[model samples]
Target: MTSEPVTLHLTVGLPGSGKTTLARDLATRTGALRLTPDEWMQPLFGVSDVDGKRDVLEGRLIWTGFRALRGGLSVILDFGCWSPEERWAIRDLAGLAGADFRLHHLWVDEEVRRARCDARWLEVPHETFPMSAADQDRYLAACIPPSADELAYAPIPDPPAGHETWAAWAAWRWPSLPRLDLS
Candidate 1:
């Protein structure tokens, strides 16, 4: 008998909100292929220095996600899908796959986010930085919160009983991956 296909769960959150960290933890647990926007963009075109290139990178990520879904791979997309339009785009892609798609919004307070940013700035490799402070400020400022109407589309609630935290779910899903102390 054919095994059941894996489900895709897209994790969305702003920078410094622990989206990537959570995604990594989830990936390790579930053995799902995690796709971070930065993973695809930085190496190909360098740091997003221009608006045009940033748009191009986003498009490429969307396309790559579509292809991966079609291939029946459970993907965890780690990106700041701050707007309803962007979330809708992801929803449409999930629909096309006929796979269950769940969104996990990494909710964190602004103070926590900024503190994480300051503390982890050096954690990002040199290849990803060197942009001016002005550029970083502009990017942060442009990150608008989701509207009430937009949030109505597909709100990400907490995981169900079998899958609670990343480690809990990961242990249940893929037993082969290395287990981390999430406690």
Candidate 2:
């Protein structure tokens, strides 16, 4: 087996799709580093004020992930990378590090996601709280969620054949790495 254990695993989904929770759980189970956009943004610009800070932090996180992969450490990136360009960037990063890259796209009903976001307002830190009604409406209008068709027909490498859950496939394919828990 190769001494290098690096692999880049990215979780893409809409807000409140359990990306952060899953990423954290995965990090704890595996020895992989977890990077969440919310965690990075909240400290610097606050969640409500992430418009300008997001661009900077996204670059920073991707760069940091690349560095970690070079050091033979796997990384889990929790971000809503709905854009095709963003996904491509991750694919390129994995190639640069010579590490296997896995993409776990979280799929949830729109109503379910919104309800979860509503409930999370009381659970998360004030700085990372959900947007106000007007703000949320505007944000939703401005940003479009990826459609099922988009995910099902992504250009990147498909998840291993016949494997439904990412955790199962990871454990089977990468026995050296601990199983990730998204639930």
* Number of the top lDDT candidate: 2
Reference-based lDDT, each prediction: 0.61, 0.66
Which stretches in model 1 have alpha-carbon errors above 4 Å?
Answer: 1-5, 127-141, 144-183
Model 2: per-residue lDDT, tens digit, 75-177?
9888767665456546645766777777777767767877788888777675356656676566456555555554454554444567554434434433333
Residue-pair clashes per prediction, in order, are 1, 0
RMSD of candidates 1 onward, in order: 12.9, 11.1
lDDT of 1 at 21: 88
lDDT by residue for model 1 (1-183), tens: 224465566776666788888888878877777777677667776664355555555555555565677777777777777654456545545665666666777768867776676666567753244434565466567766665644465454333466544333333332332332223
Clashes of 2: 0
Worst 10 residues of 2 by lDDT: 173-182
Deviation (Å) of 56 in candidate 1:
1.6
TM-score of each: 0.67, 0.71
List ranges where model 2 is wrong by over 4 Å: 1-5, 48-51, 133-183
Question: What is the lDDT for 53 in model 1?
Answer: 59
Question: How good is model 1 by TM-score?
Answer: 0.67
